[model samples]
Target: MTRRPSPPQSTLPSDPILALRANELLARGRQLESQGKIADAARVSAELVNVAPDLAEAHQFMGSMAMRTGAADIAAMSFERALQLKPRSADLHIALAQALLALQRPADAARILDKGRTLHPNDAGIFRELGQAQLDLGQPDAALKSFSRATKLVPNDLYSRHMASALATTGAPNPGYVAELFDSYAGTFDAHLTGKLEYRVPQALAAALAEHGPVAGPTLDVGCGTGLVATTLPETLRPIDGIDISEKMIAKAQERGVYRHLRTGDAHAVLADEPDFAGPYGLIVAADVFIYIGDIGDLFASLAARLAPGGILAFSIEFNEAQGIAIRSSGRFSHSPAYIHGLAAANDLSILAEVSHPIRLEREIPIPGRLFLLRRG
Candidate 1:
């Protein structure tokens, strides 16, 4: 998480003695930070309040240090104090917005970002953060507008452009956007998905794959977040390879120690670009990954070329009534059953089994999707 710029000594208390001391202490803190003495810097920042209680920069430094050390609650409190001292500071508002997001107060973060917009109407960074907050709150329409505003304000920033384009139409998702989105969710992903959301795609996929038989040999786990699917894999399938766009998710997956190799990139490209891959892959599994992928024709082509004869490709997809694929208002894609079956046949793959189930809970309501097992013919 990046913090906004700190105010200079000129923005501190008017008393010459207090301002000089605050500046001196701020310089020492910087030197300590440069030397990797983070705790010392934090201690110095804490002492600044005693000398210059009215200095917003001191509280800003304290907030930055707290955020650095993962004390989001403390960071929020410090940032709130800084904001109170400098109510109209755009930078302080942005800092507080980020802290609120870390604390799972996205609605509050959205409101603060709105405040920031009023202060810095032309600042693209404010719009970007506002878009993220809106998206996190499940208001994609609002997020789309905010992201569009960011792209308009910062035309040179490709990231904002990509996000706007991705949301503009139903097409292939922007890998960069999806990666960053999941990276932000990585810390709380497992708990939120399994605990309150009731994510059971992995368990269901494993059950279907086992019942289908020949569950043997190497496996490729696409979007294998935290290796939840790998836990149920047969021991014979040693050295599973997992591919995900998020580096943080890969880090969490590595903790499971079940994967032989894990890489960060688009799953389709990661699997397609494996030059050393000799024999056909025995099994390839994707649990709730395709939702981020709108059209699967390209992925099917890659799988048709690499999947072993009689080897199975198992995955889950959100259900949709659209004629083909549709990106939900929440920014997730859903595939029509007719679309999946049609694509499978066109790609020389035979559907082994397709089961309808509630994939997960969205706002505590069941989200229905289908799990399919496809075999290369």
Candidate 2:
């Protein structure tokens, strides 16, 4: 199982009266930030900086506030100062690397990340940022290494999932562990996935459907979260159906009125039960849904069996070129292009079109999104 790094403990002095005052101010600032009063938090953080200019914690807090407020330059300066004081802090290095990336100085970010890894080689967050910096610098090979290290260090991190996907662009095999990790996250899936991740699988599927013309009979939106994709379906295709493993997510999807049917069940098993679902669906769409399934052989085979002849299957996946599909300690599977092609061919599905593009997540990270339009032969 992938382990997350524990939250950092407060190291600031709690005994000295002056230090206690600074801690109080910092605590208040954090509360304000959590309450969405970023401006007020900044003001408090500024006061902390004045009282403890050499305090690494103070600088780090101010840096986070600046970054949150779109003050990238200021954030960088604050983080730099913090690093100078606490050069061993891996979290500080990650923050500084992010600020540098915001300023499009990936090379510099990579340098800091290297130093961070040296200090905290076992920290997954350091490797994640390092991998991201390498990717931004167009060093796919290096990025792949960093991401691989990150998954080993912190297999459960979703950031590692994104990093693994990015590295896959270099034709590296997909990381095998991502699927089960995602399946675990499926409980809180919609709440954590939408709005930020620019999860356009739903949108991409909609676009594919639009390009192909109307979906003919009943339709199923597999792994439909919050009904974002289901709602996008044309009204003519009423009685749209959706299925997901997370009951909480299915509830949210139902609230959107996008699907005539919504059920909480395994995607593969759900379709298997509905053998007659074939021909009823003019289209079957899975957006950003297959990343959690390590082996698409079963999924593709099941989908082909469920589709009518000439019926389309549109879905989104985070592609990887990694070899031999295997599950990682992280629980998600990365797919190789060969693996994807093999699945399509084995299932008797013809790939009509496939497009690769950047997918944005909630934290402004751009993940690679692969869209495939398949027709069952």
Give the number of the best model, judged by TM-score: 2
For model 1, how does the per-residue alpha-carbon lDDT over 1-377 read when each residue is reduced to its tens digit? 89997643326667898889999998998889889788888899889877777778888888988877667888899888888878888888889988888777889999999988998999898898887788678786887898889889887665565556666765556656677778989999999899878998898998898788776767888788889999988897766888888999999999999988888887667766766333367888889988877777887677666778887889999997764876553456789999998988888889999999888876346888999999986
Against the reference, the lDDT scores of all candidates come to: 0.81, 0.72
| Per-candidate total of colliding backbone pairs | 0, 24
RMSD for all candidates, in order, please: 8.2, 7.8
Assess every candidate by TM-score: 0.61, 0.69
- lDDT digits (tens) for residues 1-377 of candidate 2: 99976543434555487687888998999999999999999989999987766678898999999998878899999999898877788889999999998877889998998888888889988887887777667576777788788887776666576557644642222343333444466566655566445455666667777887655757778777667777677776666788876666777787787676777777777777754343357788887667665556666777777777777888876656566353222223445567777888888888887888555442354655578888876
Off-target runs (Cα >4 Å) in candidate 1 are: 1-147, 153-163, 167-169, 276-279
Candidate 2, position 354, lDDT: 83
- Residue 355 accuracy (lDDT) in model 1: 95
Worst 10 residues of 1 by lDDT: 271-280
- Could you say which candidate leads in lDDT? 1
